[model samples]
Target: MNSKLLARIKVDAYCDKHLFYGLTNLNDGFDDSRIKYFSEKDFEVVLERVKSLGIGIFGIEPWKNGHYYDCKVYESHTSDPTDATWYMTCFENFKKRGDNIVYAASYFIPKKLLSE
Candidate 1:
C-alpha cells in the first residue's frame, strides 16, 4: 500500500475504535505484527516494490456502519445479520479478479493499546 493510502486506512480504523479492537482480537497476533511491520515509509516502499514485482494491488475500503460492499463496489447490508461470515465471502469476488496481489485493508488494525 502507498503511505497515503495506509495513513488513510489507519485514520479510518482509529475512528472506529470498537470495531478496530474487535477485529484485532479476531485475528490473533497478526494485527499487532502488521502495525509494527508497516511504518508509513515502509508502506510507500512496499507499494513501489509490489509494482516492480508486476503485481496489481486491490484495496477494500470499509463502508461506515456497513457489513459489506456489493459486487459492483457499492456498500450494502447483508441479508442475514446473524451471520457476519459474509464479510469473508465478499473476498471471493475479488479473488476472481485474477491473481496479482490482493491486500485487504481490514488486516491492519492493532492489537494492544498504544500504552502497552
Candidate 2:
C-alpha cells in the first residue's frame, strides 16, 4: 500500500494560540508541531517534494470555522466526533469562464482510515 499525507498550511487569520496551528498531515508520518505555522513559500517547496514521492499533499484553509472552500468533506461510520474525511479540491482558473478560484485548503480523514 502507498502512504499518503494530507497536510495543511497554517493561516494566521484562522488560528488560535491554544490550538495547534502548524503544518501537519492530518494523518501520521509528518508533524511540525514546534512551529505554529508555515510561510507560503516553504509550503510550496514541501508540496513539490512530497508529490515527487508519490504522496498526495493538500492545502487547507478553514473559513468561518466550519467551511472548507477548497476541498470536499466526508463523514465516517464511527460515532466519534473526530471521525471524518475530506479530499483536496484545489483548483486554478476554476470554471470555463475563469471566474472562481480557491487556495490554501485541504481535506482530512481521521487516522488515515480511508484508502486511495
Candidate 3:
C-alpha cells in the first residue's frame, strides 16, 4: 500500500461517508473552514500523526492493487471489479439502509500508508 494510494482511499472513504467532494466540503461536525485546510501535505502529516496515535492500517496487497474476493464477485467471473465484484450489493445496501450499511462492510487499507 503506497502512501499516495492510502491517501486517495482516505479521501474516498471520507467522501463516501460524508457525501462530500473534499475536506473543503465537509460540514457534518467539524468546522468546514478549519477542516478545509487539509492539503496533500496535510494528508502526509495526518498519516504520520495517525501512526503516532497508534492506529494500525491493514489491507491485502492484491486487494489494495484492485483485486476482489471471489465469493464477493458479481460483476465478472474474474477477480477484477470489471469482471465482477460486490459493488451492486454495496449499492443496494446503501439504498436500503443508507450510509450506516457501509460501516457494516469491512475495509482493508494499506499499512504502508501509516509508515513514516
Candidate 4:
C-alpha cells in the first residue's frame, strides 16, 4: 500500500470527530495494533490533512488558531488509570477488554492576531 495514502487514511479515520487532534480507544489492540502516528515521513502529510478539514482547533474561531496545529500521535496498551507514561510505548493487555486508547498532541499556534 502507498505509504502516503496509508498515512492519509489514518488521519482521516481519526478525524471522524470535530477535534483537530485527540485520543481515543477504538482500534482494538489486535490486528490493527499499529500505532497511528504522524512523525518522520508521515508527519507533514497528516498535519496538512488535519489543518484543512479538522475542527475544534479554535472552537468557533478557526481563523484565530490559524486553522490547526502540529500534531503528534501516541498509543497505550493497558487501560490502567495509574499509567502516566503516554509518551512512551505501551504494551499491556487491555486490548482484550477493548480499552487500548491512542493519544495525540498538537501544538497550537501561539496567541497572535489574525491578519485580515
Clashes of each: 0, 4, 5, 0
lDDT per residue for candidate 4 within 1-116, as digits (tens), equals: 99767654554444544333443433244323443332222323333443543221211101111223223233223343222233222222222234323333332222221111
Model 2, range 14-63, lDDT digits (tens) per residue? 22221223443231213334222233443344334333333332334322
User: Stretches of candidate 1 above 4 Å error?
Assistant: 1-75, 79-83, 107-116
Task: Please tell me which model should have the higher lDDT, number 3 or number 4.
Answer: 3
After superposing candidate 4, which stretches have Cα over 4 Å from the reference?
1-34, 56-116
Q: After best superposition, candidate 3 residue 70: deviation in angstroms?
A: 18
TM-scores for every predicted model: 0.26, 0.27, 0.22, 0.23
Q: 1-116, model 1: which lDDT tens digit per residue? A: 89778675664554244222322222224434343223223333433433343322233332212223223221354443222334334445544654333233432323242112
Off by over 4 Å in 3: 1-85, 93-102
Best by TM-score: 2
> Sorted on TM-score, highest at the top, how do the candidates line up?
2, 1, 4, 3
- Writing each residue's lDDT as its tens digit, candidate 3 over 4-58 gives 6767667456434433233232223333222332333333343343334343222
- Between prediction 1 and prediction 4, which has the larger TM-score? 1
Ordered from best to worst lDDT, the candidate numbers read 1, 3, 4, 2
Score each candidate by Cα lDDT: 0.35, 0.30, 0.32, 0.31
